[model samples]
Target: MKIGVLALQGDFDAHRKRLEELGAEVVLVKKPEQLDDIAGLVIPGGESSTFLNLLGKEGFAKLKGFVRMKPTFGTCAGAILLANEVENPKQVGLGALDITIRRNAYGRQVDSSIREGQFLHDPIEMVFIRAPKIERLGKDVEVVATEGRDPVMVRKGNTLAATFHPELSDDSRIHQYFLDLVTNGKH
Candidate 1:
């Protein structure tokens, strides 16, 4: 199967490398048209507002459409983009995932750190950098991982979002889980 990583900004290369390491054909998607060829998409961590400016109107519309139909995994700023509501200065989102996110809720960039979070009942390393916090989640959303009482990673249908950057860590489970969702067509 093929996976496309959003290359408009941020550390998209890291996501590309991780997906490639898992034996999937990876595409650094720089254009909205690229969305048509990939089975799944990975939106890497970046400035959410910057992504909006870069995507413009047509590209944003294309992305909004793609995420609704295809399996899409988003991390950090990507998570913000996927949320239904954004705070700490409201912003429009794709509404792909039923959750409310607060930008930089974990604190400033200097406060970034590595911590252990529970994933599928097992402890996993999570890297949070200027991360958004999942404030409120809709009933359909499942908490896939958590740091303390906060939902760091969540899933609902074909949309999976992580407030932390899974690609930044050594763990393959998170990415693998996303791949599984794509492979099984299990939302």
Candidate 2:
């Protein structure tokens, strides 16, 4: 299956490499039209505000529509963009996941760290880079993984999101889970 990684900014290349490692065809999508060519999409972590401007009105509109229809995974800033509500400077999102997110709740770049979290009942290393935190989960949202008492990874139907950079880690399970969503639609 073909997966498109938003290459506008952030660690998209890392996500692309991870998807490729899993034996999936990867596309580095820089334009909104590219969304039509993929089965699923990965929105990488980066400056959320910058991403908004980069996406422009048309691109953002296209993205907002795509996420609602396709199996989409958003990481960190991407998570912010997918949230129904955003704190620490609220911003509009795709509204794909019914949850609230607090941007940079883990502090700034200097406070970044590597930690461990549970995924699929297994230990997975988590890399946090100015990560956001899930403030609330709607009825349909599932907590896939957590760091301490806060959810770091969550899912709602075809939408999966993470506050941490799973692409930076060696574990591909998270990506694989997203792949499952892409292939199977839902559990």
Q: Which candidate is the best by lDDT?
A: 1
Q: What residue runs in model 1 are displaced by over 4 Å at the alpha carbon?
A: none
* Model 2 per-residue lDDT tens digits across residues 1-187: 8999999989999999999999999999998899999999999998989899999999999999999899999999889999989999989888899999998897888999999888766788999998888989999899999877778899988899999999999888899889988999986
* lDDT of model number 2: 0.91
User: Per-prediction count of colliding residue pairs?
Assistant: 2, 0
- Residue 16 of candidate 2: its Cα lDDT? 90
Clashing pairs in 2: none
* Model 2 regions lying over 4 Å from their true place: none
lDDT of 1 by residue, 28-83 (tens): 99899999999999999999999999999999999999999999999999999999
Task: Give lDDT: candidate 2, residue 132.
Answer: 88
lDDT of each: 0.93, 0.91
Go through the candidates in order and give the C-alpha RMSD of each one to the true structure: 0.9, 0.9
- Cα error of candidate 1 at position 129, Å: 0.2
